[model samples]
Target: MHCYFHLVHTHERILDETGIEVSDLEAAHYQALKAIQELKQEGEVDDVDWHGWQLEVVDEAGRVLLSIPLDAAQH
Candidate 1:
């Protein structure tokens, strides 16, 4: 399955052009976890909530399947 990972930040919104590939819906959760980690690294901060950021995982049809909030990722 192909999923779109869009970054919904407090100041900006980023749309992912190339989606990610996963075996199934369950695998998409793992990918979302990894993507959040990368985002944290890019921000040079372990806690992304300071900037009020979140990752929205959407299906091919544009339906949001899940939202990974930076604050939640800290836990």
Candidate 2:
């Protein structure tokens, strides 16, 4: 399955044009977490704020599969 990870905050969002291929939803979830971790690390180094951001995993039809809070990467 292909999943697009969109960075969103309320009505604002940065859409993912090219998505990644995964075996299943579980793999997609893992990828989202990994992405969040990388984003958080970059944010720290670049002094960017991502307090209310979320990573939305969606399918080809634009149906959300998972919604992960950016701050969850802290754990």
lDDT of each: 0.80, 0.85
Highest TM-score scorer: 2
State, as a TM-score between 0 and 1, how close model 2 is to the true structure: 0.85
* Each candidate structure's count of clashing pairs: 0, 0
Number of backbone clashes in candidate 2: 0
lDDT of 1 by residue, 1-75 (tens): 799999888778889989988888788888999987776678745633435777888889999888877777765
lDDT of 2 by residue, 1-75 (tens): 999999999868999999999999999999998887786677661465666778999999999999987665565
- lDDT value, candidate 1, whole model: 0.80
Best by lDDT: 2
